[model samples]
Target: MSEHAPVEPGQVLPATELVRDRIARRWEGLNERVQAKVQSISGLDRTPEVRLIQQASSAGTVTKRVSWLRKAADHVHAGAAHLAACRKGCAHCCHIAVTISRAEAQVIARETGAKLNPKAGVFSMADSEDFGEAFKQATSGAVGKPCTFLTEGSCSIYAHRPLECRLLLNLDDDDLLCQLVEGSATNVPYLDARQHHVASVAILGQHQDYDDIRNWFPQGRANDTPSTQHKAD
Candidate 1:
């Protein structure tokens, strides 16, 4: 049969149905072992510190220099490579209070058409009452709680996950991020502390405030409710 045959007049397909079909087809191409790996890591437990790392926004300006970012990009890319190999069901990163730059947020919203919950007020890195104070109290920047996006052991907006989300992999121990910075993994270079600090500051300034991205998210999703899974069958 021709791949691009015209459809019958007046026959309509629901967009959601089409999306599900596409999801299924994509998964079908993967080998069984690879597919199984994705599933295995999909719902791993979150460490309490992960949330802090997400919130620890940098408090400075970004130079936007390509060379500096280029150096950091390799580490991120290596980290992402490890992450992509993970199972579909593994969403431990989703459990953290993820923050994004204005650019990242815009891309995600545009791509996924997912709207942030209006109930949760905008989150800001400058808000002394929230992030600043939290920073003072906690050794790590995480919120010590699962992020609101997590539901039913999954991320509600998986397709539009931010850069940080795409970088996480199973650590096997609670202090993974810390270890990455301090460990001896040959392939994985330590992420430059200065670069991350500058990047965080740049993101916060671009948004004019941290709350800008928070304004996009919704609130009051059941804490333990897992997000609905979408994959080809």
Candidate 2:
């Protein structure tokens, strides 16, 4: 899921095969145009993506890199706008885990003056099998909770949100399957933006570990962030 890093004890992502399998299943159902677009995105060169990251790195700011990611997301969204389930005021995806790098958390904390939760590692999507039952319980408990920055059915930090949040697009035709409910599963189809995820990791730094957004802005509110006048729609 991350760009690059030396494999560490608990950092290795779990369920890679499962995600690929799911992508295959989703691919089988996409419309021809959508299928062609997905293939085009998948067929893009990996080297150029890394080069783009290097260029962003040379710009000397994580925000710039993240902004580039947002633009990349916009391009993706534009191509699939007709079918993407994601739209303003529809944020069912925000209720689940949202990962961000430490540097991203720092940027958000600095910009919004939001006190970070300080608790780390517990909410990472990486295989937390080593953390035992506590991790499992926390993962389950986090599923239906609204993000700290979610307010009035919108994200308070939409302009400066994390790459994980930016690239999370539900390719379904509508929001029905994206709705969250306990004891039920959803078959939402999303692009496998692994190349971009890797680029994101590279831009942020390979050494930085990922954590959930709740851990980054535990008590922050829409009003606590940039004044309404400054917030982006």
Estimate TM-scores for all models: 0.39, 0.67
Candidate 2 TM-score over all chains jointly? 0.67
Off by over 4 Å in 1: 1-75, 78-88, 117-131, 134-152, 170-197, 203-207, 211-215, 219-233
Indicate which candidate wins on TM-score: 2
lDDT of each: 0.39, 0.59
**Per-residue accuracy of model 1 over 107-131 as CA lDDT, tens digit each:** 4555555565433334445565676
lDDT top scorer: 2
The global Cα lDDT (0 to 1) of model 2 is 0.59
Over 1-95, each residue of candidate 2 has an lDDT whose tens digit, in order, gives: 32223222112134456544544554464666456656655654455445555566676677776666666655544454554555555666767
lDDT of model 2 at position 64: 72
